[model samples]
Target: MKQGLIILGVLILGLSSCRKDPEDPLHKTPSSYKPTLVDPATIFPVGKFGMPQLPSDNPFTEEGIYLGRMLFYDPILSFDSSISCGSCHKQEYAFAEPKKFSTGIFGLQTGRNSSSLYNLAYSRKFFWDARQSTLREQVFEPIQAHNEMAMTLPFLAKRLARTDRYIEYFDKAFGSNPNVFDMSKALEQFLMTLVSKDSRFNGFFPGKFSLLSDTEKRGALLFNGLVDFDMVTGLATGTDCFHCHGGALAQQNNPDMGGIANNGLDGNFTDKGYGAITGNPADRGLFKTPSLLNIAVTGPYMHDGRFATLDEVIDHYSDNVNYLSPTISPMMAAHGNKQLKLTPQQKADLKAFLLTMTDSAFLTNPAYSNPFKK
Candidate 1:
């Protein structure tokens, strides 16, 4: 009888040990936990353009987006945990840094201006030089760049593994034992959710012309090349801007539509732009044409961040264009040595038109804001 009682007690002890504790870090998922799968298309609808290109292997989920949002705002991804992806890409500035060049983790400045983060769902190429082919691949570049986050994938993975919250998030986001690929996918999912189609300019496309002021309306026409000013005849015609920055997204939709252009920023190919990536001389001085959305807030324009204001940008196109570059776009060449010669009123109108592209809702949306801050 004594032996049987001892055996029963031992059995009970073993069973209790096998039972997972509610607070155990490794077994954090509760019995009620269920994966919440979310369709990326539902959150980011296809507007005038077709569906956003998403990787089939890494479809979005509520859990994944949550994890990605945390990672994006967390300084843990940086070498010293002092800077985050959000450091440069602030939500209020349309996910663009206000500075001409964003300072990195170690106070090192980036080579190019930080581009805005909206409407990336329509983009096939990433970055000013169009070097990265996909969004997921692009996420890793800034994290590993010496002047940026400067953290290795292996180190990041190990550091994340030590945190119980991160481990739980990883498990919920990418099943057990999440790796760097999982982290990148989560970041990509969050970024894909940043859609900016509700701008005032969007109203004009839907026949709501009243949304724009008179000055802005004229500017819109000039920007889309609906009205141009002939240099020699002093007559108004198309500005010829739609050739590079057109479509519903107000940026090049594909490579065939001149995704990158020399833009006549410089007479000499000092930075070499896309030519440096492809090692082709003809591609020199060629840089990707960024979207005009939120141009009012995303100041210090151009690849090198030379123009500090929209007025300066307009002045460059109006009176000063570098035609000496070998790879200057044919559309720009059509203008020849003659400038657009926009009048003062015309320039102001154009600036007003660009301001209408600002999506007030996107700039203040809590979802895109830093999660760490109260």
Candidate 2:
């Protein structure tokens, strides 16, 4: 009987040895995915961009991301526990607020629109007003803001510390201790993994997904200037859409000629974007021009979320240069009297092209979803 039991145990051990480990494929590592050239028809390659500066103290970890996601969707961060980050930034709308600006937990509306969290790993600035520099710092803004979450960090930390659920999560994520409830670091790990590089626009990014529709191909020609000037502009004299919205990312912000343009906002408006942060006259009315990837879903456009639709945004630029702001971008002024006057058919084509920027894979990815589900 003892010999038979020993033989059975040996057989079980051997079977288990042959099975693949789930955690082996995805382990805790500091290294990023290597950039690979791919056929655009097959797989979308990750977009090339500057690596966002991460804090050395709070390194990225699966446990931390998992915890951050719970905190992000949980209303416990709010004073009334009625609102969360997901409250404003809905996944259906590409993680952007549906309204012009999101109403906070207290029913007071925020001054600026909620920017989409898509590909936020690449962004240097956080808010439309450019208040927070890092994503870590940005997470704290809504928590303390009277209009947003309206919960004090220290008080909230205390609230979380008392909880058995959080205590286990925090200890697992960041070593077991009394100081493990630091919310900022935990939140940053989660935000870092919110990468969105799977867009159709990413097809052209590093030569991936080569197959594109004829209209989309033509639209790409117009966007990247593969087509002739008259054909692209419909006989307009000046301005190319890709000039300002440049690079693989579609939003240019280089060191020499950084592309944060004022975009000819009518001086009648009050929102002074970057100027609010630096207090520089040159930086007035200049906001960070975001990536066009998933642009279709993230609407109510512009810094203030003034234009509700893409057509309105395109129409505003079509021969209606309100060069009233002192800090209006020179590129806007250079558009001259005439605009990129596209025919009805061409406009439709452009809209279709914009739609191609949508990356459903990233939008619906389970990795970035709220891990704490009922």
Candidate 3:
């Protein structure tokens, strides 16, 4: 009986030794718990765009950006787990899809064209209708849109908490359990980092005539010149594009000028655009004017994606200004209700200048690409 009791005690001791001890509070955080903050100056063109007005609450961090990128490419954010934000906004097309309308959850169509995502940090307004005021709020719209992601916040929170990677990343990025608020801040951090300033248009400046071809030079002249008629050809030498799309950023960020305008796509409003949002009739037909940084690729232009090609777009401005539209842009109506009537050569030149805005680097930058893809 004595030997048996000793043996039992030895067994218990061995078993207890093999079992794990209680975890230390200091070991709770991973040894790699370091949130490297990203400098806004490194990503933003401070000298050119005057340092994009970033959200003070959500400063850029490497971990947060990576987390947001994973979320962007992850379809799990959607109701059916089918499409992600990246699905509508592809990196190859400067984060703006080539399709006329974006296909959302259950293959439903979005109301407007997928706006290109870049240089957005510089602009205060968002969406083609300028509905949202900030990127964090903007992301929630598509995620919950019945026709888009069709996701509910409660479900999204649960799904995010369910994922092990999100759990780890959420802790690493925000030192919190997977939650929707941090998710939005992470997304905002990533979206604002998408800066597009490497295009040829950004490099070309005064006395840089050699940088452009003769045709492009003429196009540049026409693009930047005032809306004055040649008197002989009854065509404008200058298209006066500066009124709306002017600036080193190739976009007017000011709300009064190029931030919003009605390009006379229609005299009557079918969508009522910003008007619907503000409940103001005067704001009807107005849409956010996106930067021309990647104009060549971000085609199917306008709020409705009406103009399929640049030629069609030019033709509308040159020959089809709808002055009869009650709320027509004062800048557009300033043309004396007459068309610019650009010549064939002039149109080609204008197109050439516009093509210079395409930044191939921005299109293929792996940083913005889908992290899931090999």
Candidate 4:
């Protein structure tokens, strides 16, 4: 009986020894975490662009990203090597040009304002007019634009090949291939990594910021569609601001839908927004609805950068453009065929809510800084 009891006790001990402990791996040293480390659950917060679906050809890698970073801040991509992608797309202003318009080669200002670079990972098409289909294709546009960089691909390749520093970088980034000399691909890789997901909105919400205040929360609720969007007036009752700019990124159209608008720019006379690209009249003034992630940062709002302040912009929308021609979007028909008449307090609250979307971490990330500097 004693021998049987001892064997039973030994069996129980063996079973306990074989069991795995949940925290055993905690003692092991971690090698390193990635620069782009992100929590999957919180990938897309309100007003934040979601993860990008990358093309198979231009797969993302740390080495490739590093190479691209060097190319982005390097002015060598330009005709005179005095300008670069970062020249107009300054980091401080959310990668937007400080001046109302951007000056390219020979001090010539481009027709449109330089758009801010954020939530780009979620973009399907690029540019104010949505001319380019892919970021890769878009990178070359400014380089070849007459008023912009004005440098051809062959010339850029020759220029890059001339420098020993570039030759070494090209070899390390791309495997023994001449294609690495094409700065566009490298720039695309770098730009793709320019993600800004660490904002007050991205991080802790109502809990983290006690200062967010009740008014701001109410303003947000209104901005989103707790209030109904008045189709007739284009003014949202109960603060239906989300109808035009609504989504995870507060964009009209996301990866799921497109937010191209014809918002009464002209009635019958038109800018022909998306239609210019497709040659379809229906697409007139149907410009890509930009993400409102950093709306406060990138202003002189709208495609033309006409309105300098949020107050002016609010006024434009609140007071419908009935005087403009007939090509206006149906949304403009909401507010009794007029614009919104938000009170002064409402406008302030809306602005406060918009400021919540700014992501400071992205604005000051050392990884995205000029690589030429130590």
The candidate that achieves the highest TM-score relative to the unseen native structure: 3
What is the number of residue pairs that collide in model 2? 6
- Model 2 residue runs over 4 Å out of place are 1-52, 176-181, 206-210, 226-234, 237-239, 255-259
**Tens digit of lDDT per residue, candidate 3, span 1-374?**
99999999999999998865433211244446878999989989777677777788888999999999999999999999999999999887889988889998888999999999998788899999899999999999999999999999989988998899998888888877788888999999889888888888888843477899989999999999989987796778899887788887788877778578887888999988888888889889988888888999998888888899999999988888898898888888887888888899999999999998899989998898898999
CA RMSD of all predictions: 7.4, 13.6, 8.9, 16.5
Name the lDDT of candidate 3.
0.87
Model 4 weakest lDDT span, ten residues long: 22-31
TM-score of each: 0.88, 0.80, 0.90, 0.78
lDDT of 4 by residue, 1-374 (tens): 99999999999999998976533322223334333422323433334454566666665656567777877787888898889889988787788876678889999888777888866656777887787778888988888887888788877776776777765655555542224334556677778777777666655443454657776765676676444555896445555567667755566654224467666655653346577887877676667777776677778777777778877776665564553545455554554464456667777777777788787787888888887877
The superposed Cα distance between candidate 4 and the true structure at residue 188, in angstroms, equals 1.8
lDDT of each candidate versus the true structure:
0.82, 0.69, 0.87, 0.67
TM-score of 2: 0.80
Per-residue CA lDDT of model 2 for 1-374, tens digit only, reads 99999999999999999976633312223133321222222222243554665566666666676777888888888989899888988776778976898899869999888888865656666777666777778888888899999998767866776777776666667644212235677777777666666677766654443566777665565665522346563554223567666666676644124456677656744877788788987787777777787889999998778889988876776545676667777666555434566665566556777778888988898866776664
Q: Model 2 misses residue 193 by how many Å? A: 0.8
Give candidate 4's error at residue 70 in angstroms.
Answer: 1.6
Instruction: Judging by TM-score, tell me the better candidate of 3 and 4.
Output: 3
Assess the local accuracy of residue 280 in candidate 1 as a C-alpha lDDT between 0 and 100. 90
Candidate 1, superposed: residue stretches over 4 Å from native = 1-33, 226-236
